[model samples]
Each structure stands twice: as structure tokens, then as C-alpha cells.
Target: MAKLFPFLQIHDFLSDKLSKEILDYAEARQADFSPSTTSSGGGMAMVTNQRISMTLKDLAEFGPAIRENILAIAPGIIEQLKISPFEIGEIELQLAAHGDGALFVTHIDTGVHEKSEKPRIISLVYYMHTQPKKFSGGHLRMHTLPIGEDDVQPVDITPDHNSLIAFPSFAPHEVLPVVAPNVAFKDWRFAVNCWIHRA
Candidate 1:
């Protein structure tokens, strides 16, 4: 079997106060939320769900600190993954809120845009949620790429508040369906999705 590196999960990636501020900011921008699409040219074959996202420009000053943190850790991540060292390029940021029954089917972040000159090389997700959390079943499941006849089991990473998870962009993964019993959009599963590209 091909060697598989575990996804890195850092606890307390951001303080409670800062995480709350980010969540509140996203909540205020509810107007921006819409059904998310997958693949290039607005294809929706791979992912089916109600979701929203904001770019770094959309975030403006609200995003620099998070961006800096990701950049600061890029060197260590690259070394661990044993990939060619790369300078950070454009970062795609999105505030993904999963309401009741929201889910993203398994897929890789890279190779979705076959024609694009620049592709995402690293995928990072920062989990944020309020105290006494309001949602359940939004764990991230990453599958192992089996090399032969042996079956590889997937790893489940719970969406812990204020935690950050990172892996290669090409890793196959999915967000298991979220069950928000109360069904409040504001109380749904929230994550700051970031894709770092090679410069």
C-alpha cells in the first residue's frame, strides 16, 4: 500500500474570542450564502448542497491573521508531506455553514480545474462553533488511497471548535452529513475553508 500521511489537526488554532468574531461576521453576511457548485464551469455533479463561500478579497482585513498563520505553518507541512517546497500563492477562503442534512460528497480539491494554470496544492479547514455546540454529525472523513488489494479504512476527524485541519489538496475526503436538529442556520456547522496554491 502507498504510504499515507495523516491529516494535521491543531487544537486551539484561534482563541475563543477571535473564533467567535469570525463566526459572527459570517452570520452577518447571510445574504452571500447560496447553493454551492462543484467542478469548473459551475458543474454540480460532484457536490450537492446549500452552502456559501467568500474569497480573501471578500474577507478583506478580517482574513490576514488567518492567512498569516497558514503561511507560517506551510514550511513544516511541506516538509512533513515531503512535497516540493512551494511559496504560497492565492488563497481561496470560504465560510461553509452546514445546516440540517448538509453534506459534501467525497472528492479531491485538486484537479477539479483541469485547464487552470494554477491548482490548489494544500487544503486547510478551521473549525468554529459556539459553546454548547448546536450541531452534530459533521465530521470530516478522509479516505486512504489503497495501493493494492488491501482495503484502507478512512479516518474521521471531529469538527472541534477553534481547531485547524490541514492536508494535501489532492487527498480524497468528504464532510459527512450534518444533523442540526434545531435547524437554525446560525447554529449550524461552520468552518473556514482555505485552499493554498503553489506560487
Candidate 2:
């Protein structure tokens, strides 16, 4: 866990073989990824220039291993972060791809779908991009509370392949712009975003 920010970081979160299969599955379903949307004050979801990326939700049926594994470790993750425990409700799992120049500016994760009966409690991001890093940027930057008139300090977390990071859904964060420079979809920054909801 981070000293100041509440988060859990685990390297090699998935076996290499399983990771490869998951990656292949996401690529095979490339046609399903649509522009990711942002939530407005009125809870409407709309695609805007502020967020440049693609997303495919309801991926659990096809990615059961990934979903089960995440559930297995969620309690430990929450315990480590010192978050109050609550009955876990439906988990929203999705595949997200960040192509060249893609980014989601500073934002919190709790209200993406405000109409849902269960609210988001924790946010997990698992990076599964190619090795040797085909792209630049696309790092996860967590923002600290402003310090006495100073701006919010930023803690940049590199999107290491096969690594998973977890934090509270209300934490302010952002996906830095990615530069994939003439590369194919495989070179894009790929991630599995899991949101644990409170029942």
C-alpha cells in the first residue's frame, strides 16, 4: 500500500499463460470495444474528447478465470487498504484499450453509473500490455489532496505488464496520455478494469 494514498499493488497478478489467453480474447473481440463514456452531473454517459479510449463491458462471461481470481483476492485487497468491509455486490469487469494519444483526464471512479442500485466501492486496474513496452505514457496517476494552497501532488504508477493495482473508487486519478507511434492494436495499452460494488 502507498504511504499516503490507500492502494494495493501486486506484480504478476496472473499466471503468464492465463495472461496471454486473456489478451488474445480481448484482441479477438476488438470489434466490440466502443468509445468509453464519461458521467455528467445528471448521471448521463456521453463520449467526449476528454476521454479517448475504447471499452467492452460485461466481459465476465467470457473471462471467468479473470473474474474469479479477482474476487478471490478482493477481500485481501480491501483489508490491506483498510477500507471498511461491506457485502460485495455485482462486480463490473471490462476490457479497456488505450490507443495512440488516448487518455482519460483526472477523475474519480465512483459515479460512472450513478443509477445502479449498488455503488462502486473499489477500483482495480490490471495492465496486460506487451513486453518491452511498445507504448509510452498511459501511466495511472493518483492525485493527493491539495497541500495548503499547493496543487494536488501526483503519484505516477507505471502500467507494468501483468501487474494489478487497487484503490478506493472515490480516489481521484487519471490515465495519462498514451503515445503508441505507428503501432498496431497489440501495441496499445490494454487493461482490465474491475469495479467492486457495495451491496
Candidate 3:
């Protein structure tokens, strides 16, 4: 299990103040949200109905902090995965909003496209949400690939505010369906999704 599904979870990755600030910025910029597509380059019809977008200039303040934090603990993650450290180039930051009933089916972050040259070595997700917890059941599930006809087991990680989760890009994972009874966009589950690529 250790070799097949290596993952790291860091609690309180950001202060309450900073976390709120980021969430506020996202809410204000919600108009820019676009339908997220599958790694296969397909349209929304092929995947779930969550909205996503690259960080805009307004989110510049978070770039350095996020990159530095990830790099600070990256050595440990690489050691656990037993992979050679590759130059971390072009850290992609994506803001994703999962509203009520939003869900993403299981998928591996790497190797979705056969002709792609750059490979994503590591995937990271920083979770944030409004206070009072208007939503429920938005967990990140990492599944173990069956070994020679063995049954797969899933590890569920709750989406707590200001927490960061990282795993190998090749690991299959999915975001469980969100249950936002209130159904307000402001109360939706938000995540700062990041991918570190080999150069």
C-alpha cells in the first residue's frame, strides 16, 4: 500500500485570515469560472460539472507562499515515493469550485493524453471553504489499484479548511460528491489545485 498509494496531508497550511482572504477573492471572481474539462481534453459533457480556472493576477500574493511551502516539504514526499527529484517547473495553480452534487470520477492526473510531452510528477490540492460548514461529503478519495485481481481499497481524506493534500500524479483519485443542502455558490467547496511538473 505504501508503494502504490503514497500521500501527504498537512493541516493548517494557511492561517485563518489568509484562508478567508483567498476564499473571498474566489467568490468575488466567480464570474470567471468555467466548466472543468477532463484530462483527455474533452468538454464538460465528458466529465462532471465543476468550475475551474487558472489563478488570475489578483491571486499573485499566494503564488510564492504556495510554491515555497510545497518545495519545503517536497523532498520528504519524493523520498517516500522513491523517485528521483526532477526540476519542478511551471507550478500550475487552478481554482476549482464544487457546488452541490458536484463530483469528479476517479482519474490519474498523469498520462491522460498520449501525445503530451510534459509529465506531471506531483499533484497537490489545498482545500478551503466558508465557515459554519454549509456543505458535507466532499472528501478526496485515493484508490489503490488492484494488484493481480485483488480488490481495491479507498482512503478518504476530508476536505478541511486550510488543509493541503499531496500525492503522486499517477495515483488514481477522485473528489466525492458534495452535499451542499443550502445550495449557495458561496458555500461551495473550494480548492486550490496545483500540479508540479518535471522539467
lDDT of each: 0.76, 0.84, 0.77
Question: Which residue runs does candidate 2 get wrong by more than 4 Å?
Answer: 1-4, 58-62, 112-116, 147-152
TM-score of 3: 0.83
Error of 3 at 161 (Å): 1.0
lDDT for model 1 comes to: 0.76
**Candidate 1 steric clashes:** 0
Candidate that beats the other on TM-score, 1 or 3, i.e. the better one: 1
Better of 1 and 3 by lDDT: 3
Q: What ordering of candidates by lDDT runs from best to worst?
A: 2, 3, 1
| Candidate 3 per-residue C-alpha lDDT over 104-170 given as tens digits, one digit per residue, 9 for 90 to 100 | 8778887422234567899999999888888899799998875555454689999988999989998
Model 3 is weakest, by summed lDDT over 10 consecutive residues, at: 48-57
Worst 10 residues of 2 by lDDT: 145-154
Pairs with steric clashes in candidate 2: none
User: What's the C-alpha lDDT at position 74 in model 2?
Assistant: 82
lDDT per residue, candidate 1, 1-199, as tens digits? 6445457888998867788888888778777776666664455444334322222226645688788878888898777766788877777776677777878778888843234456788899999877788878989998888675655578899999999999999888888888887766667788888888876
* Candidate 3 error regions (>4 Å): 1-4, 41-58, 111-117, 148-152
